[model samples]
Target: MTIESSRAEISRFRSAAVAGTLTFDPDAARRCADLYEEQAEHLAQLRQALENASETEGFGGFVSAQQLQAGFAHKARDAAELLDRYIEAAYRMKEAFLLSAGLYDEADAAAAAALRAVDTRVRG
Candidate 1:
């Protein structure tokens, strides 16, 4: 798939990740799958581009398949890390919502204390 299409898929995945459902939403799972697919597609395109470039006489010596693969692997690792961050943020949001719902007084107290600490630090 093309970069644009991969980007569109990732956008959809992000939307799904943020959209909640009643039960078994599968949004997170879908997001994970979409992310994986996007990474794979991106790697494939990179590999193809590298291969094409290597076939050019002048540019052939510029890069090797191993180097291209390593670059793709690095990008894929970055993508995975990004996905982990997104998932972590989503879970944190969910946890905060649940905490606020079930322990409003405690959450409020904590927030107030945190604000006071920040204010003191800023003033000091």
Candidate 2:
């Protein structure tokens, strides 16, 4: 991936993320799964971007101080990986939310199940 391609992928990912919305009991599984898969792909793209960044070291060496600062591939890669981990956790939260909905037949029971799912997911 070149710098141009990385920018394109990042733009596409941002568009997709912005277009997504969370629904409580409606199409939760499919919606969450779709987003999870997209985020996973985004992670792969980010990795490729980092690889491209590393290969662009020669270009960075001839650039100005500001460009050198901006060319810090390792930092960008670390931050992106960390963000992906958080995104992965959010997908799990969505899954837990759906599980809560499915585990109970009554509204009150669903509330209890939801609480348990959220607590367990958040704490552990």
Candidate 3:
């Protein structure tokens, strides 16, 4: 998903969670985690490509070539850094989804146990 769509989804989740109305789906969470991981991998590949391009031989003695090379190097570095940040963010999102799934599972188990205890007392 695009960044805008992710942001919108996150906002919706935050609102629902705060209101105690969020519905947790383990399968959906797993799928989201997988997508984020895929995104991170793609970003990593792009970053590697950028790194390779940045290492290209510098220009010869010509003044314009030298200036252009310097500018390109600077911009390339900035782009690589931005891609690195995006990769990190994507991994973090993947982790968050996985954690949410585990937490939801735990919460459901706890609630079930609590209900079982109540039912035993009522039926005893």
Candidate with maximal TM-score: 3
lDDT of candidate 1 over 62-84, digit per residue (tens): 55855665666566555544433
Q: Poorest 10 consecutive residues of model 2 by lDDT? A: 102-111
Stretches of model 2 off by over 4 angstroms after superposition: 1-27, 59-71, 101-124
- Give all candidate RMSDs, comma-separated: 14.4, 12.3, 15.4
lDDT of 2: 0.47
- Sorted on TM-score, best first, the list reads 3, 2, 1
List the global CA lDDT of all models: 0.42, 0.47, 0.62
lDDT of 3 by residue, 1-124 (tens): 8656764665565455435565447788678877877887798788778878877675888999888888887777778766765665565555455445555553344334334433533542
Per-residue lDDT tens digits for candidate 2, residues 36-119, read: 546645654775576566444454455585476565765765655554444444344334434433422332332353344345
Lowest lDDT block of 10, candidate 1: 91-100
TM-score of each: 0.34, 0.38, 0.62
